[model samples]
Target: MNTGAVLLYHAAQLYCNLYKVTDFQAKETAGIGVYSALSLINHSCYPSVKHYFIGRSLVMRAVRPISAGEELTISYIKPFQKAKKQERKILLQRYWFSCTCEACVNDWPTFPNLPALRFKCLGCKNPLDGRPRVCYACVTKRRDPDKPQTEQMEVVDSIWRGILNACCTDLALNIGQKKTREDYLTVCQNLQLLYEHVAMPCQHVIIMHQLLYKYFEDEF
Candidate 1:
């Protein structure tokens, strides 16, 4: 028999004995006890089969149900932990295909440092110097600039309220209902506007776009 046929035969025989199903056959041998017909099963970054060894006998079980006409798949490696680029490169060489998994595709990007604010002295409204025991102007008046200024507080509270209101309104619209294409598109547009107006520049916009893309793509 050809290599493919041999592998299939072995896989069928092994599957039958392992699962106690009697209808399987091994038609070919591929290496590492992997049979040809079974080797026809493809690799998925996310796989249905859980590959394991039972005392040197290769065993696989369905992690999820397999449907008719669906290609059988097994993972090339562990799912959760992050792997170094070099490690992935070596694995891809062995597998003979480039890894196009979500983890591989979405490598994290660096974020910028936060904006700095000037600290002011309460008594004179002057910028504070480094490590001063007390502001010279504030010491004589027994005033503390560290306390929240009422005007500043009011402005901050108003901005916070506006953001909260927008968020709550969006949640009400989207939650607990089947969203239509128009509804999803509207939400994405709204979110894009809010992020542009409110969030700092150089912030991660890709995450926002990805969230919208996932829902829209799933619809299609």
Candidate 2:
């Protein structure tokens, strides 16, 4: 019998729990025991069942309904990453068979790299070789490119929120009244500018403005 058929038989014998099948019958399958019963379910590049683990237990659920006579299948790994050559080696060594899946047919890369959405500074764009510093050219630019500007604004907004939260909780004031007032005023002014220009005038900015107004009103 093929590796997939053998796995199915083993899964059936273990009452359909791949985890238990692998754990109890590991010596029978060689240390190549299945990580999930779903693993024994055979493989298709496009599979119906999505398998994951709930702690040590292998959990399998239908990604879509299965029809009769269709070989029940699960993914050996993410289809996008499993090149034909690599998959064949794994299946031959571990499952004792060869794989013939659509993913393999297409000659997809064994490890697909995900695309990044952020722009890097022109001077320090290397992914592996730099401790990034603000580039002089970037500083000279009138406006930052979208990605860096978005990141900077996010940091500033987070700091402003932290300051507001501290004021609301009375933590800032408890340290020293003068210091608290100065910090609060600085945060409020910076927040106002960030809200107007950087935060896109979102409702959160309006709410924060209302909160700051109430805080100062009550204090004064």
Candidate 3:
């Protein structure tokens, strides 16, 4: 019997279906395992669901509101909310599939040191590149009404950029440590103040949402 070959094949199957079992409370890798149901869910960089370990039982919970019939998804990798599309693709290569998640396809800006943030057009509320005074759609609204308009309602990109820059600088002081519960609460509240102004699919918002979920799930 070719025992070595059998073990290799078994390892490959596990690689494709494995889930990193994270200690929700400790926020670290406890181990890995295979789950039949979870392996069926697709991968999205900006996943709709986040999973964690609870004493060998894997629990999947939605990070955002999903519409009826929307396909369920969970990220195959971690800390990718800030990564570029190409970088993310490289990280996900082990899964043997190219990621086309909303964040990846649109190249969503990451925080702490975000690039020039983009906001919506004041006239038509469509996303305008580089803060243009008026977007092409709004300018040619009457002439070409069929132009696509973004549903994301972003404004004050510069303000958020500055806020994150300050945040990252402060956070660097406490690197490799979780923020105090009070710190998370304060951050969440401050984010709420400008929550409405932020565009859909924002990386900072997504990352914070995941953190809050993890915190409350384990601590509370």
Question: How much does candidate 3 score in TM-score?
Answer: 0.59
Per-residue accuracy of model 3 over 117-188 as CA lDDT, tens digit each: 344454565555643434677673333322322333222444355446546634653475444556545445
Question: For this target, which candidate reaches the highest lDDT against the unseen true structure?
Answer: 3
Please tell me which model should have the higher TM-score, number 1 or number 2.
Answer: 2
* TM values, all candidates: 0.29, 0.30, 0.59
lDDT (Cα, 0-100) at 169 in candidate 2: 53
lDDT of 1 by residue, 86-106 (tens): 466566575567766544565
What are the per-residue Cα lDDT tens digits for candidate 2 across 137-195?
44433244455556655766665676566455555444644334655565566554443
Ordered list by lDDT, greatest first? 3, 2, 1
Stretches > 4 Å off in candidate 3:
1-11, 113-197
How many clashes show up per model? Answer: 17, 1, 0
What's the C-alpha lDDT at position 82 in model 3? 64
- lDDT score for residue 214 of model 3: 42
lDDT of each: 0.45, 0.47, 0.63
Q: What's the best-to-worst order under TM-score?
A: 3, 2, 1
Residue 54 in candidate 2, Cα distance off native in Å: 2.4
